[model samples]
Target: MSQYDHPTNRDPSNKTFEPIEHYGVVGNLETCALVSRRGSVDWFPIPHLESSSAFSRLLDGGGGCFAIQPVDPFESTHRYRERTNVLETTFQTEGGTLRLTDFMAPMTDGESEISERTLFRKLDCLEGNVDLRIVFEPRFDFARTEPTLSATTEGVHATGDETPLCCWTTFAAQPFEIDTAASHATATATLTAGQQEWVGVSYGEAVAPTTETCEQALVETVDYWREWSHSCGNQAECVFGGPWHDLAVRSGLVLKLLTHDETGAIAAAPTTSLPEEIGGVRNWDYRFNWIRDAAFTVQALSNLGHTAEAREYLSWFLDLCRTTTPADLQPLYSLHGESGLAEQTLGHLSGYRDSQPVRIGNEAADQRQLDIYGELLLAVFEATRSGITLAETDWQAICEIVDYVTEIWQEPDSGIWEVRSEPLNFVFSKLMCWVALDRAVDLAEQQGFSAPLDRWRRHREEIRTEILDEGLDPTGSYFVRSFEEDDVLDAATLMIPFVGFLPFDDPRVRATIEAVDDRLTSETGLVYRYDGPDGLPGGEGTFLLCSFWLVDALALTGRVEAAETRLEELIGYVNPVGLLAEEVAESTGQQLGNFPQAFSHIGLINSALHVSRAKGMAVPGTELIGIELGTGATVEAVRDHNHSDT
Candidate 1:
C-alpha cells in the first residue's frame, strides 16, 4: 500500500472568497491572473485583459477556480519576486513546507507582441513529505458556459467554445480524474524533500512543458523582469531613492503591467466591476484606456526612465486622434483604439463580494470630459520637453485638440470624477483647459510648430482670469468644486499647484489645501475625492489617488515633513506584496475598488518623486508641465511670498 493517503476534496463551490488585499497579481503584459494567498487562481481573463473570464471565483462562489493547496490545514504567505511581477507563495503545513511560484511567460524586449498565452505554476517541496491537491475548474464566458473536460495525454483539456483551455502537469504519480458532470478535474500528489512539480495552463493550444522547459521559462521570465527593472530611471538617474524606494519600484512595475505592450494603451485597471463600495452600485468597467489616466501614466513612467513607453503611447494617442474629429473625442477607448464602449451589465455572475450589477464596457466613454484635452496636451508638452519630437501630423492633431478646447472651455461637463449628475462648470476642468492652451503655446513657440499664437494666448489668459474670479467661493478663501456647488470643496483642487495653474504658495491655493485637509480628509488622513453628491446610490471608500495628491500638495507647499509622515501612513495601506487598490475603506482600512489600480500606482510614483525632490533630492523629469520641484529657492520663495502677503 502507498504510504500517503488520498487527499480530501476541497470543492470550489465551498471555497470562500479572499479579501481584495489578500491577493497578488501576475501578468505577461497581455492578461493577468489574481492568485489568492490561499493558493487559488481565482480571477483570470483569457486572450486579453478585457476578455470574459475563464476563472472568476473572485466574483461568484461557483464561477470557477484552479487551486493547488495542501489537503490538510496550512497557512500561506505570498510576495512578489524582487523587481518583478512573479509571485511566490509559501505554504507551511505540519508535515513540510511547499512553495508555489506563479508567472505568465513574458514577451521579449523591444517588442509588444505576445508569443505565449500561458500561466505557469511550479510547486517545490522543501522538507518532509507533503500531500497536495490540485483542482482545475474553468467556467468560460463569465460562467455562462460550462466547459467539457477531457483527459489529454499530458493533462486535462477543457473546451467551451472556440477558445480552448489546456492544463498540463508533470505529476506522473497521479493522473487527473475528469468529472464531466461537475465540469472540473482533480489530481493528488505526494512529494518529499527537494521534489518539485509543474503545471501549465494555456489559453490557446496545449503544449505540455517538461520539467526542464518549465525551469527555463521561469529563469527567462525572472531575467526579463529584472532586466526591465534595471532599466528604470532610478537605476541610472536615481529618480527615486529613499526608505520608500522599493515601493516606488513596485508601483512602476504595476503601471508597466497595466500597459498594453502591443498598442501602448494602459488600462485603468485589469478587472471590471470590483466595487468601490461593497454591495453598492458604484461599480463600473475600468479595463479600457482613459485619455486622462493614460496621459498621467505616461508622465509617471517617463519620469521613472521608461521614455520608450511614453513615445509609444503618444504614437497610439496620435493615431487615435487621427480617427475622429477633435470635437467628438471620447474620454476612453478600447485597447485596440476602438471608441465605442457601450456599457452593459453581466447579470449572470455575482459581483465581487456580492456587489450587484456587474458591469463591463464603460459608458463614461460617451461623457464629455474636458480635462482630457488639457491632460493629453500636457502629456505632449512633457514629452516634447523630454526631447521627444512630434511629427508634423502629430502637431496638426494637437492644434485641433487645442482649438477644440478654446471653443468649449466655457462649457460645463462631466469633469474628471465622471459624475452622473447634472453637468456643472467644474473649476478643475477650467484649470486644465488653461493647461491645454498654456502647453500648446509653449509647444508652438519651442518646437516652431505653426499655430494661431495670439488666439491661443487670448483664450489662455481669459481662462486664467475666469478661474481666478469665478472658481472661488463668496468668501474668496479657497476654490470650490464647481460654480453651482460653490460651498462644496473638492480634492481635485489640490492639483492647482501640480498643473502650475497657481503657485504652491498662492493664498487661494493655500486656503484650498487647508479647506480640503479640514473637510475632505478622512479620520485616518486619507482624502475623499469629494463629499458632494455624484448621483450615485452609495458612498465609496476614500480615494487612494486623492490621498497621494494631498501628499504631493503638502510637499510642494514646503511641508516636507508633514508630507513624509502622511506618505508613510498611506504606504501602510498597501498590501503585503506592495500593491495598492483604487481606494481604501475609511472605517475598516480594507482595500476597496479595483485591485492593483494603475492610477493609485501612478500617484505613488509621482508623490515619491515630489517627496524626494522636497528632501533636496534632484529627481529627473521634475519639470512636468511647468510644475517645478525645486527645493531651496522654490521653498524659500514660497515662504517669502507668504510672509510678504501676511
Candidate 2:
C-alpha cells in the first residue's frame, strides 16, 4: 500500500511515528509545539507562529526534530495540567515507567513585552532503571539552511542562518556531539527510580539555564497558569458545569495559545499546509489572522464573561483601521498587523501525508468576503453590551464598514468558506449583510451616537427581504447555499439563527437546521462543510466546526436531549489531550487539517455554552453544578430533564 493510504504519526521517512491525534500541544502564547505521544517535538516554529520553522518533521521527513523518548517499546498516555497548557505524558516500559512534562514559560499577566523564547521539558523515572535517548536538531528556514552546531560551556548551541538556539541537559557532563550527516546533536542517558532531568532550549539570545533554574521555571509557570485561569470568575455558575468545566477552560486556554500577546491577533491555526484531505491540493496556510474568525472568537470569549480578549482585539482592530485604507479591508492580515500576505508554495519539503503544494501565505487574503462587516459589527455590539464603550473614532470606523457593505451587499464575492470557485450571491453572505446593518443600528441607538438610522434600517429590511425571497429553495422547506446555483445545502447556513438573522424557533431556521443535519451529517454525526464542488480537487473530511454549530442550534431550539447526545459523541473524538483539529475523516476517524485549530475549539466553547444555558444554567459568571456533562452522567438522565421546563 502507498504510504498515504493510512494515517501514521511517522513522516514519510518510515521512522517511528504516531498519528496526528496522538500529539499533545504546549504554547507560551507567542508560539507552540506539537509533542508526540512518544516524546518527539515534531513541529515547532521559532520566535513566533509565522517565523521560520526549526522543527518541521511534521511536514517533511528530513525536516528537523528534537526528540526525547525511551529507547525501548512502551505504552503511553498523556494529558494537560489541570486548567493549564502544560502537557504531561507517561510512558510505561517493561523495565520502568517514566513521565515527561513539557511547557513554554509565559509572560506574567499585565506584561506587554516578549523577552523570552524558551521551551522546557522534564523527565522523571518513577520505577526501575530506564535508558533514554535525546536528539537535538536545529534546521533553519524550513530545513533550507543547516546551522553550525558547536559545544558551549554549559551544553551546546547552533549558530548561523536564522535565530540561534541554545540547548542544555541536566545529566552529568551531558556529553553532546554534532552529527553533520543527520544535522543534529545526540545524547544518551540512564535514570533510576526517583531520578529526574531537565532539558531546555532558548532561541534568540543565549542564556545558560541551570537545572535549578529550569526546575524553578516549571513551578512558577504552573502557578501562573493556575492563577490566570482561576481569575476567569465565578466558574461555579457559568455555562461550564460539572464534569465539562475543565474541558471548557482548556478550550479557552487553547484559544489563548493561538493569539499573539502584543497584537491580540488570533491565528486560525498555528501550522500551515496541513491538508484538509490526505494527498490533496486543499492545504493552505492558516497562521495569519482572519478578521471574520477573530471577530467570532471575540464574541465567544465575551459571552463567557471574559472581556480581556475582546478589549485587546478591539484595540488591535482600531490600530488596523488607523493605518489601513478604510475603503478596502482584506480577509486576513499578518500577526504584526501587516495587511499583505502573498501566497507561496515550498517545493523542497514534502507535505503532511504527502499532500503536495505546501503553501506558506494564504491566497484568500485578496478575495472579497462580505460577511466580515457583520461579524465585526456584531462583535462590537456584544462588547458594548458587556460595558465596553468604543471611542468616537472607533465608532466612526465601524460605520465605515457597515456603509461599505450597504453598497456591495448585492455583489457576488467569495463566501465564508472561501470557495475558490466563481463568486456567487451566497445566501450566508446576504444574511450577514443584514446582520451588519442590524447591529450597526442597534449599536448607534443604544449608545445614543450615530447618523443614518433610517437608511440603515431600510437597507437591513431590504437585505432580509431579498434573502427570504430568493435565497430559499423553491420547495420552501430550507435555505440554499447560493441563489445563483442549483439547490445545494451548506452547513454555514445554520448560522441563520446563530447570528440572530431569525429566531431559533422560526420555522424556516428550524427547517434549515434539520435539512443540514439530514443531508450533510455523516454516520458519526459529524457535519460535512459542504457537498458540491468548491474549486478544489480531492475530497476532504467532515468539518468539525460545523458539527459543533449544529449542537448549538439544536439546544437553542429546545432539542436539548438530542443536542446533549450529539455533543457527548462529538467530544469523544477530540484528540487524546482534549484538543481538536479543523476536520476529521469519516472513514477512519483520523484527524485532518491543522492541529489545535482555533475555530474548532471556539466552536466547542460556544456549543458548550449553549447546551449549558439551555438547561437553565447560569451564564458564565455564576457557579453551576449537578449537570452530568463530562461527569459520566448517563444519557438516560439527560433525556429526563426538559431544558425549557426549568
Candidate 3:
C-alpha cells in the first residue's frame, strides 16, 4: 500500500469509522448524505430530510446505500472549492488518482425552491489515468424490497414489487455489474488524464429523461451556490482569512433549504431515527425544527445579512409566541410553530442494527423545558432590530412570554440537551430567560416596541443576579449545569459569552470554560454537553458543535493558535463528503445521531462570524478573517449537529 494510503490497521468491530471520516455533505433540505473519505456515500434520507431513509448505512452498514467510489477502498482527501458548497474529494489509489466532485444543484439565486425535484452528483478525473466506478443500488424501504436489476440503453435500474418509487440511474462510461450480497449493481469506467465524466443518480415517477446536459446542471448549481454564498460577506477578523465565516454562510444557506419555504418550518436536520449510540434507543427523527433551534437559526441568519430569512422565521416565531393557554411554550415545536408533535415508531423496518422502534415524532414536545421562552424572545428581539415592526397584539404576546419566564425562570427543568433523566434548574435555560426579558426591555426602550419595561427589567436583573451568585458551583469559579447538581458542568453555559450575557474575556467566563473543558471534553478531543445523569441509556457521540464552541471560546479568550488548531482538527472530522453527523464517537470515529444537523450548522455560522467580528471587519464584503453571514452573528464553524429533549 502507498504510504499516503490509510494504514491497514486492525479493524475493530464496534468502531466502523473515525470522527473525521465524514468529509462532505450534500442535501436538498428534504434529504442529505454523508460522504466518507474513501468516496463512499454512507447516509442519506429522501422525499424529505425527515422522511424514512433510502440510504442509511451511517447508522448501520447493513442498511441501504449506493456507494460509488474508488475501488480498493482507502482514505480519500476532500476540500470545498473556495467559498462554495461544492465538495471535491480525491481518491488516491495505488493504481491511479481519481476525483469525485459532489454537490446538490443549488436553487437559482441562492434562494431555495422547495418542491423542486432534484439532487445532483458530478464526477471529474483530476490527474493520472484512473478507473471510475459507479453503483446503481436501490434498497427501497431500506433494504425491504428485493430489487431486480436491469441494464438498458438509458441506464441501469432497479424494478421491484415496490414499483416506480424505487428508481436507479444508468451510466455509459462504465459497464454494470451486480453484487449478490448487497443486492445492487455496479459500474466501472476507465478515464485518462483530464477526462471528465458526468453521472446522475436521479429518481422520478416515470419522468422524461434529461435532454439537459450535465453542463447545464453544473451551471445552474454554480449559480445557486454563488448567489447564496454572496451573503457570506461582511464580518470582523476571525480565526484566519475567513474559512470559518465562509463555512458558516454556506451552512446557513444549506439550513435554509431544509425549511418549508412556503411555511417557514425548518427541519432540525435532514435524517431521522439515526441513533446516537449503536443499539441504543437514542435514535429520533430530526425532520421537524424545534422552536429552540429556530431561535438560533434566526439569530445566526440575522447577523449573516439575511434580513428576509430572519423576517420569515420571525413571522413563524411570532405566531408561536402568540399561542394562548400559556401551555404553548413547549421545549420543542414544529417548524411552523406547530405544537402537539405526537411521537410514533416505525416497527416494520427492523431498526438500524436493531436499534428498535425507529421513532418519527418527538415526545419532548410535551415536556415543559423553561428554555424555550428565552430562545423565542431572543429571536423576536432580533426581528425588531432587523427592521421588523411588531403590531400591538404581537407586543402584548411578547409580554406574556416574558411573564411566563418571570414565573418559571426559577423552576427546575430539563436543560437544552433535553436530558430525559430529571428536571433541574438548568443555568443555560435561566440565562436565556434573562436574555428574553432583557432584550424585550431593550426593544421597548430602543426600538419603541411597546411592553411593560419596568417589570421586564426587574425580572431580567433578578435572573442576572440570581445566576451570578446562586448559579455558581460555590467551590469553583464556574456554574453548574443546574442548581440541583453540585458539580454537573454544562457546555451550554458557554453561550454566556456568545449571548452578550458576559464578555468573552471575563475571568469567570474563562473559569467556566476551564471547568467545562476539563470535565466534559473527551480523550479524543471532542466536547460533550455534560455527563450528569440524564434519563437516557447508552452513551452518545461527542457534542460536535460544543467542540466548535470551545474553539470560539479559545479564540475570543486570546488563544488564537490554540483555537485555530482546534478548529482545524475539528474540520478534519467532517466526512469525506463535507457533511457532519449530529455527533461523533471519539474512540470509534463513528458519527452518531441525526445527519446534517442544523444546530451544528448554526453554531458554525455564529462562531465563524464571531471570529470575524473580533478582528474588526463588520462591513458586508469586507475581508473578514472569518465567515460572516450577512446576519450579525459570525459562525466560527459549521457542523450538521442538532438537539432536543428526549
- How far residue 27's Cα lies from its native spot in candidate 2, in Å, is 1.3
TM values, all candidates: 0.93, 0.91, 0.79
**lDDT per residue, candidate 3, 1-646, as tens digits?**
1122333311111224433334467655445666655555656555555444555555554455555565453446677665566677777655667777766664333444322344455666666766655655566555556666665555556656543332334344455677766577766777666776655555444432343455565566666666655342345432324655556656766676666665576777766677787778888877787878776776666655567777777777667666664556676666455676788876665565667667777888877787777677667766665668988888888877777778888888777887787788889988888777766776678767666678877888788887877788877578788877788888888777555566555667899988878889988678998878898777888988788788777766766666666776776665543456778887787777776777777766655555544443333122332343322222321110011111
Q: For candidate 3, which ten residues in a row score worst on lDDT?
A: 637-646
In lDDT terms, how accurate is model 3? 0.64
What is the C-alpha lDDT profile of model 1 across 277-304, one tens digit per residue? 9899898888889999998887777666
Reference-based lDDT, each prediction = 0.82, 0.78, 0.64
Backbone clashes in each candidate structure, one number apiece?
Answer: 0, 9, 65
Model 1 lDDT, residue 247, Cα: 89
In candidate 2, stretches whose alpha carbon ends up further than 4 angstroms from where it belongs are: 1-17, 109-115, 230-238, 616-646
Candidate 2 yields a Cα-based lDDT of 0.78
The best candidate in terms of TM-score: 1
Q: What digit string (tens of lDDT, one per residue) describes model 2 on residues 467-546? A: 88888888877898998765799998987755556655567878998899999999999999877777877889999889
Candidate achieving the largest lDDT = 1
